[model samples]
Target: MRFEGKVALVTAAAQGIGAAVARRLADEGASVVVTDLQEDKLGEVAAGIGARALPLRVDVTSRDDVDAAVAAAVERFGRLDVVVNNAGGCIVQSAPEDTTDDDWRAQLDLTLVGASRCIQAALPELVKNRGNVVTISSVNGLAAFGNIEYSAAKAGQIAMTVNYAARYGSLGVRFNVVAPGTIRTPNWDNQPDTLERLSKMYPLGRIGEPEDIAAAVAFLASDDAAWITGHTLPVEGGVLTGPTVLNPALSKKEYPGH
Candidate 1:
C-alpha cells in the first residue's frame, strides 16, 4: 500500500492504459479519480475499483472540463497527490504532407495543451501535497515511427515533463514520463494481424500489455522513485535497441561462444 493515503487523478481512464493505471493505484490504496469522455465505460472502471474510485466525464481539450474535474477530485478525495496525464492519442488521419493546419491544431490541442491544462488546474493542490505527475508518452516520440503528428505530440510530453520536474523540484514535486511501445488495447482490437507482425519486431517476442505500462506508472508515482525525476522511461520491448532483423543471427537466443 505505497499510496495508503495518497489520492490520484487519472485522465482518459475509461479503458486501456488509463483504466489499468487507475486500478493499479487504487489497489495500492490510493483514492483515484478516473476521468474520460466515455461516461459508461468510466462508470464501469469506477465500479470495479469500488469506493476508492470516482468516475468523471472530462474532455481534456476543454479547459472548463479539465478545471471542473480537478475541483471535483479535491472535493471528493479531500486531497490530491498524483496526476496521470493519460488523455492523449493520435487523432490525425491525413497524410503528413497533406495534413492541414486544423489537423495540427487538433492533434496538439488534445495531446499536448490538454496535459498543460490539467497541470495548471491541479498545480495548487499538487504543490500543497508534494505530488507528482506521470505522463503517458510513446516510443513513437523517441524515434520516427511513422505518425509524424502523433510522434511530435508525444515528444512534447517528454519535454514538458523534464521542464516541469526542473521548475518544481524545489517545491517537493516531481514529473516523469512513460513512453510505451505498441500495446494491446481496444484501439487495436481490429488489428490482430498488425499486432502479430509487430510482435516479431520486439526482442521480447511480444507487444506490451496495458498492465506493463501500469506497472511502470505505479513505480514512478510511488515513493520508490523518490530520487527520480525529469526522466523518460521507455517501456518498449527493446525495439529501441534498433532492428534485430537486420542481423538475423543476433536475434537467436544462443551465441556461438555459449
Candidate 2:
C-alpha cells in the first residue's frame, strides 16, 4: 500500500514491461493511467488491472498526444504523483551502410524525443506532488550495443535522467533511469538465439522477467526511494559485472555459473 492514494501515469502500457509496471502500481493502491498507441489493447490491460486504471491511446512521439495525455491524467485522477516513461522501442533493424536517414531519425524520435515530451508535460504536476519520474532505459544507455542509433538515443535518456534530477532535485521532484538487460517478453520470445545468448551474458544465468523491472519501478515511485535519484540502474542479470559465458550451446566451455 505504498501508493495508497497516489496517481500514476505509465506510457506504453498495453503489454510487456509497461503493462507489468502499471498492474503492480495499481495493486499497491495507485490510481494508474495506462497509455499506449493501441486503444483496444490499452483498454484490455487497464481492465485486467481492475478499477484503478484509466486507458488512453497515446503516441508519445507527438507533443500534442503527450500533452493531452498528461492533461487527461490530471483531470481524471485529480493529482499526479508518479510517471513512468516506458514508451520507447527499437522499431527497426540496422546495418550501418544500409540504414536510411529517416529510419535512424525515427528511432531517435521514439527513444529520446518521446521521453522528453513525457517529462516536459509531466513536469508541472510532478513538482506539485513532490513526486517522481522513472524512465525505462536500456542497458545500451550505460554501455554499448551493436545497434548504433538505438544505443545513442538510450544513452541520451540516461543523460536526460541525470539532468532532470539536477534541475528538479531542489524542487522535490525525483528522476532516475532503469536499464534492463534482455527481458523475457513477447519480443524476446521471437528472437532465435536471444534467450540462450542473453542467459550466457548474465552472471545470474537467466534473462530477466518483466516483474523484475516492475519491482524496481514501484520502489522508485514510492517513498522507499525518497533519497534516491539521478542514477542509471542496471536491472540486467549482472550483465555489467563482467563478460559471462553461456553454457552447453551458446556459452563457452568454461565460465562462472549463476
Report the Cα lDDT for candidate 2.
Answer: 0.89
Model 2 clashes, total count: 1
Best prediction by TM-score: 1
lDDT of 2 by residue, 160-200 (tens): 99999999999999999899999887776678586887687
Off by over 4 Å in 1: 246-258
The per-candidate count of clashes, in order, stands at 0, 1
lDDT score, candidate 1, position 19 = 95
User: Candidate 2 has which clashing residue pairs, if any?
Assistant: 246-251
TM-score of 1: 0.96
Writing each residue's lDDT as its tens digit, candidate 1 over 1-258 gives 999999999999999999999999999999999999999999999999999898999999999999999899889889999999999999998899999999999999999999989999899999999999999999999999989999999999999989999999999998999999999999999999999999999988899999999999999999999999999999999999999685354523576552
lDDT of each: 0.94, 0.89
**Backbone clashes in model 1, listed as residue pairs:** none
Query: Stretches of candidate 2 above 4 Å error?
Result: 245-258
